[model samples]
Target: MSFNLSTLLMTIITSIIVIVIAIAGTRRLTTGVPKGMQNVLEWLVDFVYGIIGSTIGLKKGANFIFLALTLIMFIFVGNMLGLPMNFITVHDEPFSIFGIDIVTQQMINESEIIENGHKVVDVAWWKSPTADANVTLAMSVSIIILSQIFSIKYLGFKGYVKHYFEPHFLFFPLHIIEDFSKTLTLGFRLYGNIFAGEVLIGVILLMGMAGIVPLAIWQGFSIFVGFIQAYVFTILSMVYISQKISH
Candidate 1:
């Protein structure tokens, strides 16, 4: 399979953005008073704390605040990446970066139309990481696995295994399916929303000068949707983790 440079690029950019925000928010630690970025950081941290506390209880939730904070920030920023702008590379030949083949000659030949002697094909070079199902599903599966690990840590090996048979052992198969379902729903829910938003933006842009107003309106709405998706993903993850441990 050909590597998706856009997805990998967006993922790296998202990670760097999140890291920069973290450092900028906490660069100057002070006890006297909070000002500037410190205040913003405190508010964001408190928001995540509220989420964790409500879902898992404050005492137990303290440990997961870092994880939750990272998820919300990374996801929110990632969802917004493809909104205001996108870069498309018009490829007429094979392309690669850093020794990894991104677009191969065979791909270009198969995809490009041989019109006269010119080959033409377009590939998106930038987009939100969350816009790709591969990235979102990976995140979902990882979270589910981590939640199971948490269940084991809190409930011990026997309790963790027993969680599936809760209420009755006959439900074991149902519980297993439930885990897989959670992964699909959680991943696709975010993916569908973000990807649809991008597709709409692309359509609007096709209108050229006529799309300015609608594009602006939709971009505003898309930003709001991005934040909501990030929040929902974070909250659902915490819910999954807490519910497993509670059981």
Candidate 2:
């Protein structure tokens, strides 16, 4: 399996940024009017809290507040990382990072990537982590699995199984398919949007000076798309968890 170095590096960077913001935003306690970062953060927390409360219920959803907040923040930040620019490099031969061969000599010799009649490796050194299918898929899958565990914890293994047969036994197959479809669509939706945005950005950049106006417009739209994806993913995840755990 091929691994994406850019995805890893960018994910780490996104996580760091999110963690730093969390720490900085809450370092001081405020009983009065929130200011600056704290104000922004409190509003965000209430926004997420209301979404979860609407889905599962404030009583049941209280446990998931932190989870929902973290997911939304990390994903939103991760999606925004690629808006301004991307860092890419070309390697004529094998390449490595941290002593690990990311682009091996064997792959280079066998690669079909050609530019100007020369075989070479093009690597993205930085971009949004959510732009990668694997990254989004892993996040989706993990959230699904976590929901299942919570289902079991709340409903017991017998209830979990029984719910699959719900409203009837014949629904078993459909329930199985529903979970599979949810996982696939959830992951693909985020990846497709971000990756497409990045691809269009690259295309516009090829237009030279003429791209300036449209590029500016597209990036502004991309920022909106990124934030919406993050919010959608978080809210849907809470809904899925509620389906399982609140039955």
lDDT, candidate 1, at 59:
86
Best model per TM-score: 2
Q: Candidate 1, which ten residues in sequence have the lowest lDDT sum? A: 104-113
- What is candidate 1's TM-score against the reference? 0.92
Instruction: Flag regions of model 2 displaced more than 4 Å.
Output: 104-112, 115-117
1-247 in candidate 2: lDDT tens per residue? 6666667889999999999999878998699988988888999999998998889999988999999999999999999999888887777756676878886444465443877876678677778999988899999999999999999999999999999999899999999999999999999999999999999999999999999999999999999999999999999999999999976
State the lDDT of candidate 1 residue by residue for 1-247, as single tens digits: 6666778889999999999988987899898788888888899999999999889988888889999999999999999999989898776655667878877554465456666687676677788999988899999999999999999999999999999998899999999999999999999999999999999999999999999999999999999999999999999999999988885
- How much is 223 displaced in model 1, in angstroms? 0.9
TM-score of each: 0.92, 0.94
lDDT agreement of model 2 with the native: 0.89
C-alpha lDDT of all candidate models, in order:
0.90, 0.89
